[model samples]
Target chain A: MGSSETFENELTQLLPRLRRFAFSLSRNGADADDLAQATIERALRSRGQWEPGSRLDSWLYRIMRNLWIDTARARGRKEKHEAPEEEAQFVGEDPRESMDASLELKRAMAAMNRLPDEQREIVALILVEGFGYREVSEMLDLPIGTVSSRLVRGRTALLEMLGGSADG
Target chain B: MVEEEKFFAWLDGELSPDEAARVEAAVAADPELSKMAAEHRSMAAGLRGAFGAVEAQPVPERLQAMLKGDGKVASLTDARSRRQARLAQPFWVQAAALAATLAIGVFAGSQLGGGQGSPIHPRDGKLVAAAGLEQALSTQLASAPANTGPRIGLTYRDTSGAICRTFEDRAASGLACREGGDWRIRSLFQGAEGQAADYRMASGGDPQLMEAVDASIDGEPFDAAQEKAAMERGWR
Candidate 1:
């Protein structure tokens, strides 16, 4: 396959994940789709800069991350996305699990929005995308310890806000 | 606090074996700590719920078109300026650009080749799995029983509670979720090198298979014990 063809084809397979990650970063369905589309454009334009045989997803993610940073900067502040009234809408919550269980997940989602951008990215990449801390550290260009600390804080805040019994 | 970080990192599977052992010991020693660990696991579940569903949602048609629109795809911020520039073009040029874009879409779709059919096919308008594939699905683990038959990798339940497993043979690769008495082939792609499973995808391989699996799993894939137990019951 030609280089551009290979790049676009790979981009299609990554659409689901790239969209999912974007949803986490942007914290809104509409903005997430916009970011994902923008990321695809950026990745294709800069395809030459990506190293051959490296993880294509990482490169796409770095582009998406930088683009989100630029948009955030242009707005002069981070946009909070979780709305208070929509707390009961988690599709994954089991109705029979418990009344508070669904509410806890809702709070967890809101608390995740409350995290710092860096920590939220860490949480999204690790907790949402299921990537490892080291992969996240490299993607964010942060120290491994920084990734862990942010994750720890993110983890604590999410659980505490969920009203888990044993928060520290 | 340091130990707390390790415990959290343990959830991400970032801890070394020894460090994970320490965290496990600490959690076991204190009921509150154990409860906290369980809560952390739920948070990961919650995280998946909050964001991962976007993956299964359809990609917007406009975004798809814009992606295939230009090599630069025209900047999102410059959409209006680009439209103005296009308006300045002769009618013939605009027509040619649209034609070229459609041609590229057709070519890209052909190249994607996601439609390659599997051994599972329709009979009497109902799709049934390959004959021996069901037995293989229950018994095979991700990295064992190296044989000339179809191999299974990373079993997990979907949001609707179907026990889904990935299988790849020479001709086809796909995810199949266990339905009553048969495996329903959920999603499929085909290629020669498609034997590459989700393992390599996570640990650094082409992510096509893993991405497909990710769209299906409700939470973490089954651990070894879980896999064994699920198999023993014949994916019931």
Candidate 2:
């Protein structure tokens, strides 16, 4: 197959991962799908700019993160209500454990959202997407130390939000 | 000796074995450190599980269609329209239509609303769709009413949050976003029935027209209750 076909195949494989990351960031199925679709569309359009040997996952993630920021900027804000409500609407579950989990998850995300966008994105890239600090640095175009410091602040904020110790 | 700063890195498995061993020993000795480590592990696992839900979701068919290149037409339609039009064209044409719509939306915007002498002025970002597109979107169901001009395919705020529809008159498929009271033509692709297919033609972009239509909302869209309320309010 041509390189184009190979590229398409690779992109297809990344869809599930991309969807997961989008959901983690947006916490809404519709918005997550929207973000993921926009990201894939953008990655395809920018195919020529992709460095062939570079990590495709990271590259795609970088694109997704930037697009998400642009969308947030365009809309001029994010909301606490939209994400969780939409998630609840989509899942349609009444399990008590799941409900408690959702409430806790919402609190955690609300806390994460309170962080500066830089720290939040770093935390997302590392803990959620499983990117190493080096990979995150490259993806975010930040210095390694910057990535490290942001991760530290992000985790501390999260722990505090969860009512746990922040000193860690 | 393990440095205090190394614990997060160690917990993340980024440390060398020697550093990890030191951290493990410290955690074993300090109850607080051990508790912190467990908490972090639990949070990480919780996050992993939470994100895992999205992975388990079936990728919506519309998304798959987009990936396949021909799905734009398919994207515009729900299952019903898809069934109706399935035999009509190849996927490339659908791709072409979708691509063409975006291309036109880029340069020839203000076609659907907000143009001089046009009936609708884009009050904000939205397109009042003149009276025409608004009514069609609101009431006209299957096709454009036989007497009226063309109709875009099924209209909805798709999963992407855009008010999208396919125009029977491919030229009329341009979209307008509603801002406050007016509609601004973000882009226009094809022409509506018999009118000039010239991408430049715009209906009167009138501010009053949008008001008369009662289309734009300041807050969340009407839920079923609000929809009923609006009907009772006579859509004023």
Q: With candidate 2 superimposed using the best TM-score fit, by how many Å does residue B98's alpha carbon deviate from the native?
A: 23
Q: Any runs in candidate 1 off by more than 4 Å, and if so which?
A: A77-109, A163-168, B67-236
Candidate 2 wrongly placed segments (more than 4 Å)? A77-111, A163-168, B1-4, B71-74, B78-236
Query: Tens-digit lDDT track for model 1 on A1-168?
Result: 477677777788888889878767763343455577667756755778998899999988888888776654433321232212222233223332223234333454457667777777888888888888788889988999998888888767766665544332
Alpha-carbon RMSD of each model:
20.7, 15.1
Structural similarity to truth (TM-score) of each candidate: 0.51, 0.56
lDDT of 1 by residue, B1-236 (tens): 33777777776677789988887787788888787777778767866875655677666564565446332211222332223333332233233334433453343345344344334655455555655565677678764644777767567888898898877665455678887877876765553231122112212111344555655668777766777788888787
Ten residues in sequence with the least summed lDDT for candidate 1 chain A = A78-87
CA lDDT, candidate 1, residue A39:
78
- Model 2 residue B157 lDDT score: 36
Tens digit of per-residue lDDT, candidate 2, span B116-192: 54433344554455655555544444322336555533233323344433233433454444333333454455443
- Cα error, candidate 1, residue A157 (Å): 1.4
**TM-score, cand. 1 vs. native:** 0.51
